[model samples]
Target: MLASWQMREGFLRSGRMATRRGVWVVALALGLAAGASAGEEFEGKLTFEVVSKQAGAQPVAMDYTVKKGLVRMDTKVAGMSNYTIIDPAHKKMSMVMPAQKMVMEMAIGSVEPPAPATAPEIVKTDKTERVTFNVVDATTLTLVKEGEAAGAGAKTYEGQQYAVKVGDRNSEQWIAKDLTLLAGFVETFKAMAQGPNAAWMKRVEWPGFPYRMVTKDAEGNVLSEMTLVAIDTKSPDDTLFTVPDDYKKMTMPQAPPAMPKE
Candidate 1:
């Protein structure tokens, strides 16, 4: 079986954002807000053709299927590998890594909010990074931030910035100036901080990674971009979020020594 690091590395190397969950939320919210004539629940399939390329490697094509609250990812890597099942409501995820011939399960839980800090303390932290939220009229919000990082400390403010705490990660978010959150930094950061299978928090702050995303269309026109995707809703269904009863389950032991990073 592939080591944890190996799996993570493979994901990173794929050149696709790992925050599929966040993207799903933002996409759904936006798609619904735009597509829906009135406030209503939406249920449909979203298909995206993922094209990836790495130095000295041939381009790779993959198909992604996302329903209301479920996702099934299929990739044509080494062997017909498939990644199925992500249920945030139940805090469970399943994966089928064909290259490693393994089926794995992971347990997850929702994040709780942090206690409020006093003004003096907030002012001190404001010198570095700070988050705030504000209401723009009645149907919109604004989140803003200004400063640098100071270790892993977190704070929340009310203005153009919003800071939400998710799990052990605190994400500082800045909402879009005009388009609410459908197309802005808040959606982008949310996607990066949380993976596709996790729940979304009102606000959060997390250590940023040293990577960026660039999106383009067939005509090479620069378009929307983000680091990962996040899905912040209940699980889709029992069958979609679990391993098939008929499939054989396998577990592999960890290697004695870790492989050196490439």
Candidate 2:
């Protein structure tokens, strides 16, 4: 039989062990909370400037604004404006034409994209690098510019450079892992990259938000380049996602009657 003192000491030691275990549990909980917050979807407006290599082609400004589960895309060039609104949950898309004062509505199918039979190989560089902007000057690839001169007044982030190849097309992306796109938006975007027309996109995937993405052809010639020039975290007005009341609804034009066979 053990003495009272021995029993008391045993209970005290057990109490100490339980206290230490409690501390570990609390610490782990806190760490998990922090990780969840870091991975939360980014809600804001993103502006990407698209540069074309064709002669006499003007640079187009593409703006995407997300708020409260709604997405809006606006493109305006040479006094012509076009807007596309998408509601993923409801599976609806609306094309708002300001010039025509019309809204063309269509139902987007909720098709789940099939997983790629094989994941594309991604190579990451050892060091982080700043994104470079390709300046096109009058039908010529003038210079590969970097720093503020290339993207003035734009937010810059140093990210890991990844080389991604999808079939014949090749692309390089500067991805900032700290920033994540809205989960719903990513799903909807992937869902839309379906069907026979978008087979190439089905093979493309992003690990995180890309600050810059440049796609090149088989010959290494630049095809399309887009850079993120601005980002705003403030929630935009809900009205931006809604069609204007004054706009008239329009149906898709029907195909012309078939010619009679001889």
Candidate 3:
């Protein structure tokens, strides 16, 4: 049986933005809105699908709706539905659990406790590639670099792909040129922009959002993958960003009192 941290590490190894339930929301929010114009606000929905090849890992689908700087993210885990609402204007984030009918709220960019004493070593390699993907339709995308039909007659996004090594895990990230709504939606709701890895992550200066990411172990076995599935420009309803009246709100869990000094 895998310990909780082991499972979490597996998710990280697969190139997830962070650990825990709100990870994807945090990761996708980071650097997402840097390109939008003030006069042209983005109000739409974006969906992503995460697939994990690691043992005991389940696929996850994330749906994000952005409106007037308010963002709502929805996903299901093990048949249970969960939601995260980010109100950047208020600098707050809310986690809604449907089954429990409870909501936990916290300020955005809250600092987490320090990690273990020894930080993992990470390195960026010199390898680079031009990845091309054929947009089959509004909801379909095919990786043309991987031998798809040459005559698909579709629009394509040329991706700047690069590799990075985090300890024993190797990951390849395919970043597409910043698209207005897609980039703006994420940047507006970024929750944890300055974490343990913020310095290193920002140092690279991603010219765009990473559309596809694949992580593999030292022995070259794939552990997980996350891909951009679709982007919907249709405006989402205001109700999707609001908390239901019947749901109870919960406070943050306080730590136990520290032991007496010797």
Model 3, span 3-80: residue lDDT tens: 656644443342222124454344344333332444445677767778999789898987777777677888865786
In candidate 1, stretches whose alpha carbon ends up further than 4 angstroms from where it belongs are 1-42, 50-53, 98-101, 110-242, 250-262
| Winner on lDDT (1 vs 2) | 2
Model 3 scores a C-alpha lDDT of 0.57
In the range 187-252, model 1's lDDT, one tens digit per residue, is 222332223112332232323321223333444443332322222223234455456565535322
TM-score of every candidate = 0.34, 0.63, 0.65
Q: Could you arrange the candidates by lDDT from highest to lowest?
A: 3, 2, 1
Question: What TM-score number comes out for model 1?
Answer: 0.34
The TM-score of predicted model 2 comes to 0.63
Q: Using TM-score, rank the candidates from best to worst.
A: 3, 2, 1
Which structure among the candidates has the greatest TM-score?
A: 3
Q: By summed lDDT, which 10 consecutive residues of candidate 3 come out lowest?
A: 253-262
